[model samples]
Target: PDTTVVVGPGGSFEVPLNPPLTNGETVTVIVTDPAGNSSTPVTVEAPDTTAPAPATDVQVAPDGSSVTGNAEPGATVGVDTDGDGQPDTTVVVGPGGNFEVPLNPPLTNGETVTVIVTDPAGNSSTPVTAEAPDFPDAPQVNASNGSVLSGTAEAGVTIVITDGNGNPIGQTSADANGSWSFTPGSQLPDGTVVNVVARDAAGNSSPATSITVDGVAPNAPVVEPSNGSELSGTAEPGSSVTLTDGNGNPIGQTTADANGNWSFTPSTPLPDGTVVNVVARDAAGNSSPPASVTVDAVAPATPTVDPSNGTTLSGTAEPGATVTLTDGNGNPIGQVTADGSGNWTFTPSTPLPNGTVVNATATDPSGNASSPASVTVDAVAPATPVVNPSNGTTLSGTAEPGATVTLTDGNGNPIGQVTADGSGNWSFTPTTPLPNGTVVNATATDASGNTSAGSSVTVD
Candidate 1:
């Protein structure tokens, strides 16, 4: 028999052994305390050599909470969480039969963790699961910036904000006053690219909306021929024109001045006579389509002469005598006649004295007439002559050797003459410099009487 003792609150007592025990023999043991208390007789069938069945009711603490439990004395509490078939956490039960199985690791909200309690006996309990309440989903994000200018995005344009993951953050409508706003954090992260999908309450976003955040403006569009007024004149290659706004900010620049005008000849020239806009813009992004002008590429016609009238010259004329005239084109016209014995006469097929200009081509039929003779065929005398380098006027120019220069009055009469020195320089000591607005004729005659075409000089 196997003997054992039982102890009560009052005193200890002996256990009666029955049927002398033998190794591996089954036996029963009973014990009574002094207080007459007795433990239910324990059957000590030979030492329980067989392993104890696995523990029951083994479980991990509830999720998000902790747990405490008792384990077999001197046994290890093995926990297999996630059911991967491996022990994650373990706690050794001391001889005192106290043990604690902690949750494997902290779990996130909305996550579930399974825990299996295993004892040193190599037996495991069914897995116990704990779940964390789902956390609030990341706030939806929605936001977009836009413009209120002509291109699009007028005030009252709807703007939607979305989350970084493209989820709708919130629903917002614009106010009638053309403005709308949302409370911060009622949505997701601030300053994020809020994909503001805005639609007018009228369901009108067909054209789509543009956005400008935090007072930023959209990129300015490119404008051609920028801004300026129209110009008229012959514009040749290499010419440029100035372009500026009312405020004087250069927006478009083109070269035309070199060619007497500006040319915007496109790579593909605009169809002939095509009217186009010549726009100007300001630096502030303001534009002016109002100042546009039409383009006319056709040039003006050349002038023509119109004198077919007959005319006659009187008085003694030298062999080199010349007559001055004018054609319908305003070009100087001249004619000359033969002379013999210091006398000459010219009768034109067309009558003169009608303010026409003519040149007299008088020659000895040998040498060129001393500077082809030029004569004015007007009923009245020529306009008053205003000499340049007038009386006492200083002259600066290259003069030919032995050059004799003479200043003439309105009637081709000499006013003053100067003889060039050996250095080809000559100065007439005029009474005074020529007065402004005065017209005068000048003639340079070589020693051979060969005179140069008359030149007119006007004082500034």
Candidate 2:
């Protein structure tokens, strides 16, 4: 008995235990009555004294930030994060017998920890061990040009590649040097971003890294109509483009603007018939197939004109070219087409006057024109001469200056010639004395090669 109580009226009394009994503890109590009367002794039992079961399946987080396990319900759990033989953290098991303990400053990777569970009655279970897993680091992705992707990660870790939608696409493993590579079954489109993660053997995944797929090359550039001196085109926005000639010589380089437009002017003009090749390169270093354009910048050859007889004119020019005739004052005269054989002819609507000049040009199909060619019209001849009667030994005449005078026999056979002086006076002595009644004839010719009608007279 722990305490005694005085008897009350009707023989009723009470006894109190000063200190509570421990789990599974027992105590015997006896009742005492007045006049030294004694009652039977009885034993009272306390709560259960069994210790909690040892924590099972103890696991430390891969990041070492937490510990988790199963234990007896309503039990207290202790964790020794540093394995120092003392608990650094504690937690109470839930009604479901599951517990989780957090570490303030996460334990180092691969660190070993100890865990124990104790019941409410103060009975402790055997210790359990858990280790913090070493998580792999994010991979370093390399810049790629095609379908193949490569990177570096922790050695012996598995690498996983996923599309932007988080769908798994491929898998590989890092080598001893931490280098890894993956090739998709099918080619990826250009500018596709893929996610990559490194997974260690313990099933711990690292933060995701990204790599952009650039398997498809850019579309062939769209070239604008250009002269040989300057080039312009459209390509992938912000990409670099290179120009080359037919002989594969580098001409120049330029970058496409935000609108995909590009232009370049060479220091020297490119010759006609140049085959220019252009290639587009994107930021990822992928080059497109060469696009080609032929240059047609040269003008047609100058035309050749024949002498005009005042009525009809003829010439030669580049085949299929448009021939245009203009006068000395640049006024349009007539237009004609050169035949396939390069032959061309032009006839004035009305006969041109003597000494009129004509100019001709040839324009090719490309609209390039040749230099002008010229010809002069000359159709009229000089005036006839005036002859004087002859003295047989000295035949004289008044005629156009520079005119030649001749003497002939009555039969119009065998003649002698002489030229008129600047004063238009002329004389010619017959090699033989002209017989009486013999005739003489004279004629004049101008610089244009036209001959005048002859004048005649009889000799004395």
How do the residues 1-460 of candidate 1 rate in per-residue lDDT, one tens digit apiece?
Answer: 2445656668755556565454457656666667877668766554323343333444334344543455567665565556686767777777876666666465554465444445554555555555544332222221232222112233555555554457765555555554455654432332344444555445534222322233222222222321112333232333233334344554355643433444443434333344443332222122333433333333222111222223555333443333333354556434444345445454556556444545433333212233333334434222222233433265333355565777765567665787666776666655666556556666665543445656676545
Give all TM-scores, in the order shown: 0.26, 0.40
Q: Residue 369: error of model 2 in Å?
A: 42
Score candidate 1 by lDDT. Answer: 0.45
lDDT of 2: 0.81
Query: Stretches of candidate 1 above 4 Å error?
Result: 1-76, 92-106, 109-112, 119-123, 144-460
Question: Residue-pair clashes per candidate, as listed?
Answer: 63, 0
Worst 10 residues of 1 by lDDT: 299-308
Cα RMSD, each candidate:
22.7, 17.1
